[model samples]
Target: MEILMTVIMGEIANRSISFLIDKCSSAPKNQDERLHDLQRLLLRVNVIVEEAEGRDITNKAMLYQLNMLRKEMYRGYFIMDNFRSQANNEEKNSEDGNVSHHFTPSKLNPAKRLFFSTSDNAHGKRELQQSLYNLNNVIVDVSEFKAFLRNYPPLYRQPYSMHLFLDKSMFGRQMEMERILNFLMLPEPSAPPITKRVAVLPIVGVANTGKSTLVAHVCNNERVRNHFGKIVFITENDLKDRGLINLKDRDVVLQPNSPLNGNGQVLAIIEFSEDIDEAAWRSCLACATCLGSVVKIIITSRSEKITRFGTTEALVLNLLPLEAYWYFFKVLTFGSADPKDQPRLESVALDICKSISGSFLNAHIFSSVLRADLSTTHWCMVQATLRGIMTRNACLSYECCVNRKNPVYVRGRVTNDLFAIYPSTEISSDETVPETTLPELLLGGVRCEGKFEVLALKSRIAPYKNYTNTCEMLTPRSTKAKRHQKPR
Candidate 1:
């Protein structure tokens, strides 16, 4: 816990520093000095925290002290984050008008007071001094905790778990993999030849539906290897400050003077996150179009909203079928061995399979938890825990297409046999959504009347129009552990 908390503190500090440097660099002249000073203090604090982190501290008292310091650092980080976000927004607004020269007499916002001067709080030098002092006290005496300063390497977040794909563990995505390959490798004659030359293929689905895993699979396919002369993989971290064009042309490591081949084709696979700037996408598209080559792009995202950004929808991955899901679950738990080989666990394993719905990610997670103990007692405990989570949700189940938002009721049937259910609401086309909505279970165990403000943006594209929509209910935490989990 101490190590993970320290790592998180480091990440927060790093992000805060990067945010200030990138966003506050163009602040008003009066605010430049304050921003620079703040950045300097943060840099000092970051160095201390990093140095302390490099040393392996085993002493319990020392560990507790470090944790206390980490808490203080977290508070500082929150304040810094608030300031940077405000400044970023203000900077955008400032671009529409001329940059202000004089400091305003109006009472400054809490964040602005840190930099902007007013009659009441002149220069904010005292507050800045106090902040630096607190950071200094928290980070003081690092060498006392360790015999030597170990040169620890900087941390980098893995794009996705390699364990999922290792030892031929990936399952039930061959059809989706082929769909991406068809879009990239197979030519579209109906569309304009030029537009087809540089087309955007979007892989849209809910979170943890293996969107990244699917893209990685397609990128590693044998056919993809022969088609494109050049391929570039873009990660979320790669677009920290630069746009996509820079990432493709400048950031990516490419061979010198490697010109396009006969087809003049370049395949770029981007793992798109929700926080991605629209300008970055446009910049990348413009660069690809100007390259005079057939730039086939594959982008993976959770929201169907990205379709509004002039992208052609290629694949919408839904949950796997029961048989395929069971195969996936079996592999994750029992490896290559047959689950029936173990007579003791056969019945318990079948119950687990039935309870998990069709989420491959959840299956992998729950199976791992079950693998910890093969005894019937542990299996029953796990089963009861999962059932408790499902039964607590008060909702109504309806049959609906996975790609559509509106739920369709089955005539003369109180109970329907669908793998997934969606919340009752109308799908909207508005792309500018302010919040995200997670779905809840609608039937069985407990019942309560209610309505939810759900955000279900349905896809209108063909083939997908008939896709079976599954509700994003509570998956086992072990499935999404990486998301909520901090790196140690």
Candidate 2:
């Protein structure tokens, strides 16, 4: 009976999603001339990007070119979406007897002030000409690319809804994923492999920049699983101790599956959290032999020093540019609801994204808040608090501090040694989250008197990791004592 009921509910959900997709897809495309042109340009670029993602793009120059095209595609969309939103805002304001069609500096939210500095009216013919020229040059360079794109089959069918796509997709990572996979399934390639003495691939990025997530997806691929006899994950602790040397005895062997293919070949993934030591790296390579004949060693680290350990060129990851991140954040914030319909909310959401400092985790958490309560007042309140928090830190991001494994203040308060803090983390599906969430704490006036865990973030993307943090509360006497310790 329960199984029947569950099946019925799931079917209903599927039908509902399909109906919405049909409606959105059938809706009229942008009628405005400039938007129509931009949309067509973006569509062509999308075709190229989508095609490239499917094939094994080993050429570094080609990968770089593909990346440049992606940047321009994103920029084009950013311009299109903002233009659409502004037009909507103007029409609404004109109807409401506020026909000035101008947003004053004072009227703009903190986010708008940070990101949208140029006057909407200032986007003259000269600027338009320059943007078109840049975009055209990219498309023109990739002209041969389009002809070749048809030869390689696509990786996956395109999704109908942006909502569903963003939910399951790894944002802005298609090219990188293809490259990593190409490196992993090597030597028998249509392309070249790394040098013979056990290939090494190093991936470097700062804290919380999708390094783990990217590698996790690559390692889980069926091709990778079938190619190696054993796939082992080694952490900083594993390398520091004699963990990897005695593999089976260690507890942190992250993902262990039966050797599907008895090739007796091993692939080792080392999370080098600190600067790489040449002697220690050599020792790691030595330990790799004990597991099996090492096929490849993928080392991921926050330190650039890891590049020295790679047999091939290292893959370095960086955060998205301001405009690109805004595009991503905007999509996440406004799901089915059209941003054009709620101009006020759009302003607030933009500011909130600005304050987040490109933290993907924060994007998940705050977008949930916006989704939970889709009110302009609620959004404004959250934005004000978020902006205040950023201001108090002198714009040193809470995300960066958390990513660096440092304790950071989440609110505006001047304090000393005995102050409070929230130490954040990203948890997997098997783990449990606390009853209290970071959004409630920051926006809903939720408070607790002692140390307790709070859900800081929950990603909708694959692996669907959730983030939590420990909230430290101080007693009145302790707080007073700390404040008095400092002489003004």
Candidate 3:
């Protein structure tokens, strides 16, 4: 996923460079210089990132910096593309206008030409320059990271499959699952009435810790199936009222054809992304409350903040124990947890499992990398790389290890020792306001505004890659200034 993201950004930069070169003749004198500088900087950074793609990037901060640079580059690319497009349209319209329309007399205004004049895109030029300058700084930071990684040479690196096969029971959280079931099944004593029988149950955890898989298990439980006659699993795209039921202020009346229309108990399994419309979600909750039958909601998200949406306390999923992780790793790698069953590979399997911090994804990938070879020498080499990555930061938890490439995730809310990474900012003055005001929609600082444009570019540039369709990152550039238009 990370490699694909960088490649998409590079493709955008490549297209933007071509666009700038083709249109430089009509652009402002200063615009071409900035564009060329940006093109050069992006090309250089692209080369560096591609070189490091196959190498293990163990540091979380360095990986974050690389992603930030990609984002800034994408923003720059779109800004340039938009400006070029506007310039082309303006020129086209000028040529197609009425021939005799309001020609300025040369004697009255000597500097005036007979043709229409285009406004100087000075604001866009400046912003373009600023974005390039910021991106250059990010490149410098990434260069420092490259230097740091140079000290640790690349180990036995292999292309690993993204898919993983594992037993759900061995992934931990049995006790937590039981707790969630109790919360969903048991009726509250202090509850107001049947009309207000709705309850929100949010399952919060970090990425790749099997949060989705765990939710799937609970949703498929036999008891849960019996309790709620009407079960609807909705994703971000299915939130519209047309396909589903319309939600009004007072009551939520389901459509006759709607699956949730009946008076039987209803269970909604909503997969919440950070960018979902808050008003729509609130309306859904209100509609549930208005529904005559008992309604239960199970929301799965990486954000701990979602817990506040539920009237009852949210359930937090913790990391699996070392024993559970071993079992998971053994089954995934050797098809069984018993080392005695596989006498030849037992020692090497234990060595690899111990080095891993209990991430099933990591184990899956590493196992593939070492799958062809059962020799002790090759196993020891792979184990050494894993240990080195882990020991780089002695105090590292599995979260940090997984976070290196795992993307943004949610943890517990702030306590005495722990503070929020993005603490709510105080709006003391208008000057203190950020340039972009929309709530963050993408996890791991990804912007979503021009996601379609980026993906469109990616598909056109490199359609041969099978996973292009799977790489869904939409975080887009900050709001741009309105385009300048000529008066009629």
Q: All candidates' lDDT scores?
A: 0.51, 0.68, 0.51
Across 70-141, the per-residue lDDT of candidate 3 in tens digits comes to 456545654544444343334444567734333322333211221122235467656777878787788777
- Give Cα distance to truth, residue 469, candidate 3, Å: 11
Flag regions of model 1 displaced more than 4 Å. 1-167, 187-196, 235-240, 243-245, 248-263, 275-280, 290-292, 308-313, 341-344, 388-488
Which regions in candidate 2 have their CA more than 4 angstroms from the true location?
Answer: 1-40, 43-66, 81-128, 140-143, 157-160, 188-196, 239-244, 248-260, 276-283, 398-406, 411-419, 460-464, 481-488
Per-residue lDDT of candidate 1, residues 1-488 (tens digit): 99999999999999999998968865544444555555566666555554554454434455555555544454444334334433443443355674644344223453453354232344244444455557666656545543333433333234433234332334555445655776777763555565636678877776546676677566655466666666776755556655354534544323334443445577777766553567877766776555445777887776676666535764787765554455456556665555434533544565567666565444644766667677767676666655544453222211122234433321111122222234232223454332322221222222112322333333222111111223422233532553443211
TM-score of 3: 0.41
Task: Between candidates 1 and 3, name the one with more favorable TM-score.
Answer: 1
Query: lDDT (0-100) at residue 13 of candidate 1?
Result: 100
TM-score of each model, paired residue for residue: 0.42, 0.74, 0.41
The pairs that clash in candidate 2 are: 111-351
Superposition TM-score, candidate 1 onto the true structure:
0.42
User: If candidate 1 were superposed on the true structure by all CA atoms, what would the RMSD be?
Assistant: 26.4
Q: After superposition, how far is residue 268 of candidate 3 from its true place, in Å?
A: 1.1
